[model samples]
Target: MTFAKLRVRAMMVALLLSIFAVGGRGVSAQTNAYATAFTTSITYQNIGTGTANINLTVYSSSGTPSAIPASTLAQNGAGSYFVGSVSGLGTTFNGSAVISADQPIAATLVQIPAAASQVKNRPLSNGFSSGSDVVLIPTVLKSFANYTSKFVIQNTDSVANDFTVQFINPANGAVVHTANPANVLPNTSVYYDAGTIAALTGTFNGSVKVTAVKTGTTNPGSAVGTALELQTNGVGAYASQAFPASAAATKVFMATSLCNLVIPSGATTTFYAVQNAGTASASVTVTYVGTAGSTPVNVTSTATTIAAGAKASFNPCGLAPNGFSGSATINSTQPILAIGKVSGAGLYTAFEGATAGSAKTALPYVRWLAPAQGGQQTFIAIQNVGTTAATNVTVKYYSGSGTLLGTHTIPSIAAGAKASSNPTSASPSAAGMGVGGGSAVVEGTGAQLIVVTRVTSPVTGGTTGEDYNGIPFN
Candidate 1:
């Protein structure tokens, strides 16, 4: 039997559980000072044949262990686990988790703040299948636009390792700050708050690169990381995973983007940052592909040269119409990495762009909660990147226990174009998920597909939303 391993960082069962109050406010960890309490949920899907037996082993910040017994899932099926509900995990757990499965699987993590806090941010991130010696974080802010950033790096190697983090100013490609966090234990994680870095003074927005080295040897160690950007005023937050250096490519695809799109709550817009990962300066161009009925537009960066290891920002405000909503393809003269951020209706979210697409994708979490129950809904965007039009595109929804709920077929999607589906809408499968949550799998016959999942709160003008990139089955 073959096994696949995935790692999830900052897997808190109930962060600061001891200090949290039942109905009122309480203080959380330093990483989330404004949050009253933090709970975590992990959703996973089986992408391989036969039944998948998944085992989870969590390691506390101090390297303590807790095990979750194996659970089984059928091929293409999905399931979820609320960390706090697990008997072995216990409350007040702050740690990282490793998932092992007999078959290939994809998982996503959701960190939710308690309702009493009135901070409706649900930060979402995908599990890392493997670690890299070098990782790139496209965006990091320190007191920039009233938002601050924090990141967690996990040591995936068997032994302790030291990681050197460098913050680079995108303007002149200078290293503004460097931090070396020493001796991070195996399977454990370390946290860093950009706001605490004195060197990154007032209003700083930059990119970050982390290099891992073995504690006592000259050899490089393996590591993975995730970052969260939160509003200092406690309004919203979003999370994104770092990209391995090897993941950078000349072409990147963002499945969802908006240009001042007007919705019931407010106007939504998408802004993205592209980082040149090569040694030489490069030029970048962004091409927007609107949904079926809209026009396509290409916008090239005015700053012709983006220095190596530096980043450039772009938005559709001036290039596309106000109501434009669609996908984007980024092309660069050298290898590049990109991440997209969406803000509107008192909500903020982020997702990483894909360097490649797959014929099958997995969305580990989808929900439809009524207004009385937080009114959370999920929207899935599927982009066809193949040369030919995509046909027989289908979405399969499954219950939390791996039961097949329903399947919905989408109309043919044109190459470079995208289609969206709301599981709670007209689809029968969506109806099967009434007032609850589940998982979904998207497959396209003879087509390359890239997916993004966005979860929104029902309350209008409420600061509550999050998004994560779909996991492709390579």
Candidate 2:
């Protein structure tokens, strides 16, 4: 603690402080140095039947004298296209690597139309044929794990073709997978997986949709293409299934958690909730929203719970009170969740027969068209596009003119048949047709329709066909 020693220490501390102030700023600048950027390009071309070629490359910015070399690139085939990434840059990138592809070089596009056509929706048949820019979905229901769906896209083109498969949750219309699109060649079918797809789309959904866009390529063209849709439904924890209990107290079933039965966007999908292997006392709560059916339907007493090691069947449509629809989440503290669906009717009818009442349900694709001006007439058409017959098909209309016209229910419609009617009277009205004029609107001020269709199928668990049309008034 000498005064001389203290003075020396202060001098050293001041000198070190000055050096830190000078060096700290210089270190910060070096660490914060900016890096150059680059870009990428991809293209696809269909040469002929079942064949497509793809080309993907990366290029650095023209502003830089020496761009990132093309050799520092890696490429992989996705659904119908190819994806590329660069490495060894040693820093985060300002310019992202560009990824592009041609539709021809991508995977095939498949369309699953409403299951109205007997031939199209029938069991075990080539659903539809494919042509240039036309994609057909085979009438097959496949499952994948973790709500991840997988399918094979067949390229019936002549040249090497590429494709891009996108996964979408039809239940809520969400995109799940995007596999950088891909390239298919003559006589080759690309088997796409969830990993590649998730990388491309940056997310995943319950069901997947494969879209084969032609990437950039020379002489890209397509002759025939198609994609498959798949879904695992949901995680096991999100679902519950069991036979009915012996006693009334045991009737209540608990699901591990709330389950979500999702459908992809732009997808025509169906879901079935069945009361399997239970007695008449077996019941469940089904909750859901959308055009599938009436929301918050309860499935009760339709299932027969077996005594001890016995089994029985319960149908939601046969429940005590009917005409209800929706999906249920097992949120009750008592914990009673409906069993997993086992090949039954649509959302509403799924619980019918198990209960006792008129089980009226709505159609998923049913919606209203835009409203018409005075003297203008709107035509709402219901087309039976499913495989099975439809019963009690109904279409309710509303006037955007701030009037409720009531509802109209159709008795039935055969497959491939089109039913069209003017929302209002076929004749024009002075200030537009009055309420109950066959014209109506849904939730908002715009014109809308409430559609309902009961499926009639020879098989116990077959689905009905569907189609829709909206005619706007002048």
> Which pairs clash inside model 1?
none
Could you give candidate 1's per-residue lDDT for residues 257-317 as a string of tens digits?
7888877778889999899889999888888868323555555434457899999888877
Question: Which parts of model 1 have CA positions greater than 4 angstroms off?
Answer: 1-14, 19-37, 85-94, 291-303, 424-427, 434-436, 460-463
RMSD of each: 3.2, 26.5
Question: Local error of candidate 2 at 459, Å?
Answer: 15
Off by over 4 Å in 2: 1-127, 134-146, 167-177, 180-183, 195-203, 206-220, 223-474
User: Highest lDDT, which number?
Assistant: 1
Task: Encode model 2's per-residue lDDT on 1-474: one tens digit a residue.
Answer: 221110000000000111122332211111100110111111111211222222232222111111222221112111211111233322221111121222122111112111221122111001111224323221112223323222344443445555654443423333444554355543334444343442434443333323443545644344222222222331111111111111112222211111233322112222332222222333333322222233443333323232211112223343322333232221122212122232212221111111100112111111232233212123343444333445655444323222334455555654323344444332232123332222231121111222222211122243322221121111
Looking at model 1, which ten-residue stretch has the lowest summed lDDT?
13-22
Superposition error at 26 for model 2 (Å): 69
Candidate 2, residue 279: how far the Cα is off, in Å: 49
lDDT of each: 0.78, 0.26
What local lDDT does model 2 show for residue 266? 17
